[model samples]
Target: MLVLLPPSETKAPGGDGDPLDLAALSWPELTDVRAGLVEALVELAGDLPAARAALGLSPTQDDEVARNAELLGAPTMPALARYTGVLYDALDVRSLTRAQRARADRRLAVGSALFGVVRATDRIPAYRLSAGSALPGRPTLRALWRPTLGPLLAAVDELVVDLRSSAYAALAPVPGAVTLDVLCERPDGTRVVVSHSNKAHKGRVARLLATTTGEPGDVVRLRALLRRAGFHVEHPGGTALTLVVPADWATR
Candidate 1:
């Protein structure tokens, strides 16, 4: 089976002299890193039609055809993310071309800055529900994506997770609606805005924060293994320790 990998720069890149280098890097640089993602996607799956569907696209996916057409010649984040969305669309699978996978890996290894969004619209409930990172001072933005595809999209959940970065990138379509918007605002302000803007339907999101009940060693090993198997795993913040395995590793 073909195992997909994420982009490498997802983790906050560190240079001897430039800790903020990752932040200052231009969109083109991010695009280069995104290209590597397509390379990995190609290695794992050769069928474009299949890949497109898995990323949550339909046979009538004419809209993305030209948008990502340039990707055929060069690997880039837009091309790869667009392609990944197509694959997830068709396959009913959550596939990250390179950037998302890489970012997920980083959050798993080293600690990461994440923003949380809630379900609501206009003068909504507070979104900084304890786990939210305070914003306004620190401006970290992340792309939001649906972790599952297919009829799953019908379930309706968006902004399942928000990754914190220097610049905000456009996110994939909302699981059911288009709530994830891209802008660089302070962290707290961003969360508040997202929380207040989008509406939510309960019981749709994956339990990434499920708590770990197993021994730390066992949990760590399982998490590492899941990552090695090429998945963007999530933790359900509990003692039970859940692993959201990628479709490719479902049998293994």
Candidate 2:
């Protein structure tokens, strides 16, 4: 089973791995799109002020523009280790067992604005690009990615558990992919969609699914697997499930 994760705006900078290599990345069909974006970004980096404006950055974020300038020659790190945010902080890949980490590498892939989708083990450099950003002399990122990404995801022969945020998910709609939603349950038996803690809950779900020996390739197996991992999961028809968490948990 493949688990699709969203990329974080905040990433861990610097790495010991070699520079980015398009041929070595997964989903080879996306190489052309990735290459085009990389070239556009590299060129955009030529004018720091213009690049910062195009990327919607404030004056304090000048370092991010510098990072973009070094995209090709910068050191790289595994995608799993590169991102840091509410979700990634919760997953804490560095704390996983060796076996669990190995399983994570095999089952996880992150949806990126810069590289399309990168496997957990794929090596990538530090770069600044938001899924919503518009580069100069190019179409919107969604337009560029939609054509190729949808077909590539649809062809995958695995039960895909999509955990990407709405922005990244808009780039490619995976056919038959099951999406997981995080909800907070109140004391009065009411449930509301979680906001701030949504990413944290999804991260925990990803870690649980990644470490487990069970292979859930369908809704039935997926629900069962999450239940066994101690989640209050509910299938709300179609290809989506809701994991109900305690209201206190979200508040915390």
Question: Would you list the C-alpha lDDT of every candidate in the order shown?
Answer: 0.25, 0.91
Please give the clash total of every predicted structure, in order.
Answer: 44, 0
Cα misplacement distance, residue 159 of candidate 1 (Å): 21
Q: Give the alpha carbon lDDT tens digit for every residue of 100-126 in model 1.
A: 444333222100112121111101110
Predicted structure 1: lDDT: 0.25
The C-alpha RMSD in Å for every predicted model, in order, reads 20.6, 1.2
Worst 10 residues of 2 by lDDT: 189-198
Which candidate leads in TM-score? 2
TM-score of each: 0.21, 0.96
The segments of candidate 2 whose C-alpha lies over 4 angstroms from its true place after superposition are: none
How big is the RMSD of model 1? 20.6
